[model samples]
Target: MSVTKALEGAVGWLTLNRPDKLNSMTRDMVETMAAALKAWRDDAAVRVVVLTGTGRAFCAGADLKAGNGAAAPQPGEKDSLDVIVDFFDTLRNFPKPVIVAVNGLALAGGMEVVLSCDIVLAAESARLGDAHSNFGVFPGGGGAALLPRKVPDNVARYLLFTGDSLTAAEMKTYGLVNEVLPDAELTDRARALAEKLAGKSPLVLARMKRVAANACDKTTADAIRHELLELRDHKRSYDIQEGLRAFAEKRKPEFKGY
Candidate 1:
């Protein structure tokens, strides 16, 4: 399959497998990932997800080289933006954190994928940018809006306006990445982080993710004001009681999705 979806240990790695085109996304690949992520949200065994791409380019964006979709983007009978937006929202609201293990060049739409991730670990030699402006379309893949929120406004503006590629080191200094590991170590590092997150209580992680997201969101103040109320509700949840009982019994909690 062009999308390699696999779960090993506490982590799920979804690799964009089309290295021939710099691991670019096709509609099928995007939808497949969205579906997989949705399933993982409910699966207890799957705690963390590592989204990456194969070879030298993390993703060359929307596979422009193929006859169907081009860099300049010819008008199509197809409605590409809608499905893509849905998937983007799925990432934005993901209950569990997603780590984007960026190992190479990630341009245009690929930049949106990274922005959507909860955490991003880039390879030391990796490059990132939004080339959509250069090609003529407003970055429908969420770069224009999301990137600035992810990083500094000036930096985001500079990248969007100039279409300049930022190096991994620059991104780290700009607070755009969790860290930058060596190219060979990027996957392993991302897996380690995923495993670390997976070790915690699933319900707690989910609630905490929502809380943290809300803190950074437009509703930060109201969310914080009502945080304890939500936390109290979470504590009364069946999973919370199970977690405490499991700890007391020295056993793993068996959650029943209540």
Candidate 2:
């Protein structure tokens, strides 16, 4: 598979797999990512996931050069969650924390994938953008929704309108980048973050994720009420009691996903 491979050890590493093409995604790669992420979502060992590239670029975008078989999508195409459907949607709503470790350029659909990640740490030389607009399509992935949530409206609009790439420093200023490191340190930094998150209680993280996701869509009164309900439900989960006991006893909590 041009998408590269494997799901193991609580850390699923998805390398775009086609470095020669700047690791641009092929239909196969997209499919592979969707399936792999889904598998990880429910895996007990997996607490954090990482996406990266194998070579010069993280992923320059969808592979235009992919030979005709499954076929390449048109520049301005849309379907009712067609073709790339599973690929984009899976990344967006994945319950577990996903991290994008950009070693180089991440453009168009590739950049869209990164935007869906819970966190992003980039190499100092990395280039990230939504160049699909330049090719005449609105971002088919979650860029339209994800970008605005991560940065200022004006900044998101600027990139959407111009289809320009942002440097690591510039991207950091806009707040999408959680951390930045030298090229050689990209994997290390990503692994560090993944390990830290993986050590947390998955049940607590899940509930926290629900609250965070919900708060963005509700009023303060509704949010508070929702949170109370969440806590009420949370009490039934073992992780909550473990967390509390751990806090009181001054020891690490052993989270059993309840």
Candidate 3:
């Protein structure tokens, strides 16, 4: 299988298993990922999603040799670029947190996937870049649009125009990466972070995710108004009462995810 899905407690792990190809993404793998994400969306027990790859590399980018070398349409086949956009959209709209553990190289399409994720924990030795220009192609996924959002326009343009790879530490400096860890400690750190999130009220986490994204595009006054409305709705959840009572009693809150 190009992709594998497994659950570790409340975290859903999706691994890109094509090590021989440096875990380059294929059409089937992208489709499989979309399906798995869709199934996990309604799974209450799954509070977070962690995406990683097996072996030394996270993903080298799209498997160009698999098709026409460009995500071009094949006879009677769905457009590969369309599939990639849908996959990114799915991750963007997913209510729960999506964390990416970038263990190694992430280029072109791989970099786009990282942009789609909510958080990124990259190994110190990992490298990231937008290499489409090197191949005479442009970002067909979300890289062009998403990269500028995370990092400065000048830096984003430099990386995309030059097709240069940045070390994980450098990417962190650009504010695209959340943390950089030793290659050996990457997986454990990612899981630890996910576990911390899982312990929170899933409903609240979902709400916060929405609020953060919504606030980004709203004006200051409108954002505050929207937040107030959301807060009113949140107070109706059972976890709010439990949290308040637990705080007063000096005990850890056990959220019911209401």
Candidate 4:
């Protein structure tokens, strides 16, 4: 399996299994991940998702030599590019929080995946960059468009133009990475964070995720209005009432994710 999935507690973990190839993504891997996200999106049992890779590299990018190599779709059929785009789209729109554990190198399409995630935890030694310029391959998974939004334009341009990788620490300083830990501690730290998020009300988290994402695309006033609308709707949710009741009772809230 190019991708492996496991459900632990309230977290759904997705690991890229092709270490020998730097866990480079193939069409099948993209499809598998997309399908997994689709399943987890509606699963109340899964309150959070963590994505990582095996071996020395998180992901070097799409496999250039793979069978599906960027070929244009024929007639009605989809191609590698389409599959990759859909995968990232699914990840970006995932209702629950999606965390990325960058264990090592993440370049090109790999970097794009990082951009799509809600939170990112990286190993101290991990490196990230956009390598498409080095090989004349324009990013098909949002590297050019999203990087600037994540970091300063100059920083994004340097990474895209130079195709040079930056240390995890550097990315953290640029605000692209949430935290950087020792290599051996990456997995545990990521799991800990995921578990922390899992303890929250799933319905509240889902609503917050939607509002936050929409805020990114709207003006300040529009975003505030959107948030107000969501809040108005959420006022009637069972989880909100339960939370308030729990607070009044000085006890933990048992959320049903309604």
Among these predictions, the greatest lDDT belongs to 4
- Please identify model 1 stretches exceeding 4 Å from their true place: 67-78, 238-258
Who is ahead in lDDT, 3 or 4? 4
lDDT per residue, candidate 2, 38-66, as tens digits? 88887887777899987879988876556
Per-residue lDDT of 48-126 in model 4, one digit per residue for the tens? 9999999999999989898544567789998676787789889998999999999999999899999999999999889
Per-residue lDDT of 126 in model 2: 94
Off-target runs (Cα >4 Å) in candidate 4 are 67-74
TM-score rank order: 4, 3, 2, 1
TM-score of each: 0.87, 0.90, 0.95, 0.96
Q: Compared with the true structure, what per-residue lDDT tens digits does model 3 show for residues 1-258?
A: 889999999999999999999999988999999999998998888999999998878998999888576555678877887788888889889999999999999999899989989999999989999988998887887788889998999999998999999999999999999999999999999999999999899989888888888887899999899888889999899999999999999999998789
Q: Which rank order by lDDT, best down to worst?
A: 4, 3, 1, 2
Provide the lowest-lDDT 10-residue window in model 1. 64-73
| Alpha carbon RMSD to native, model 1 | 3.4
Q: What is the C-alpha lDDT of each candidate?
A: 0.84, 0.81, 0.91, 0.93
Regions of model 3 farther than 4 Å from truth: 69-77
Instruction: Output the better candidate (1/2) by lDDT.
Output: 1
